[model samples]
Target: MIKDIPEDKRNTFAAIGLLTVCWASAEYALDFIIRCVHERYGGSQIREAPPVSFKGKPPYLREAFANHPDLAGYLPQLNEFLEEAWQIAEQRHWCIHGSIDLRADASTFPISKIIHGKEHRQDTREFTARQIELLAGRASALSVNLIFFGIQTVRLMPKEEANKLLRELLRKYSAALPEDGPF
Candidate 1:
């Protein structure tokens, strides 16, 4: 049955799957941080996450940290990570909103978004199979870093114990978490 499929379709589908997984990881990390902040601020009274959302996540995250008076002293390394993560801003935008052109052997994706009424045609990019795979790996790494860093730096949770609990939570929620995730 698999043999009947064309190579481009198979490859594109695989990349698409990876892209979704990577996207999910990033989204989960963002939501996780948001949830933690909300709960820490006494949102626990509602027993559900608030309806708030963020645009330009990095800035929002930084601002979120600032808003939490307690975390005002969050380590300089956390600030540094946020700065480095911003470097991927273009790639992440293109991977999600861009159109993918599937040819005989690979895919090229390009993205353009109007922000503040300005056309952003500057950051267009193309991706090969290897590049897409690398992006997936990088995205996963970014999320894991966010999870660990957010817990340690933002939540002020102890690294070893917090991560151990997080790993267990991830394992337990591995099946249901994605499905239950934000759309």
Candidate 2:
């Protein structure tokens, strides 16, 4: 399908691909942070230190919450959603990246690792199929958002305005999906 796309459309496709990569990467990192937080905070009587390490300032997640202080107001629920989204993003990334090993059979990789942590433990084939489905859905959603964002950016919209639009789009899209648990 990508090969069949016209030259002009190719650039659009490429932009979408880049945005998807960015989104996936962000999702992965956020999930990692959320897992760290949960393992530190959830259930144990001892107050564990925050799992995130910092160079100068606190971790990005903390900083993000701080900068958008309202996020801290709903910390528990927000962190839960963030963790869920992160897990889906992590699985999607793994499936996409693992498929790159063209010479090896799928069985050579640990099939158990793919679906072990999910609430519903699907078989390897089902897991892979679901991941592919998610990827396709995410790509379509991201592409539409990217097109609109690009148009707004090119129109010389204020940075804050553009960021607000992007954030709202992502929030809506993420809210529409099923929660997948922390990575």
Q: Residues 1-183, candidate 2: write the lDDT tens digits.
A: 768755543443354355467555544444444444334323112223333322211244444443443345545544544454445455555554333322323322323233555475544422333344555566445444433432332222355555566566668877432243110
Which candidate achieves the best lDDT against the true structure? 1
Candidate 1 lDDT over 1-183, as tens digits, reads 658767755665577568668857766776677677666754344335443433455555565566666666763655775664554445556666665554444444433433444654444456665666777777688777877767765463656666566566778867333432321
Candidate 2 vs. true structure, TM-score: 0.32
Candidate models: Cα lDDT each: 0.60, 0.42
Q: TM-scores across all candidates?
A: 0.61, 0.32
The segments of candidate 2 whose C-alpha lies over 4 angstroms from its true place after superposition are 1-22, 25-59, 62-70, 99-130, 135-183
Candidate 1, residue 90: Cα displacement in angstroms equals: 3.1
Model 1 clash number: 0
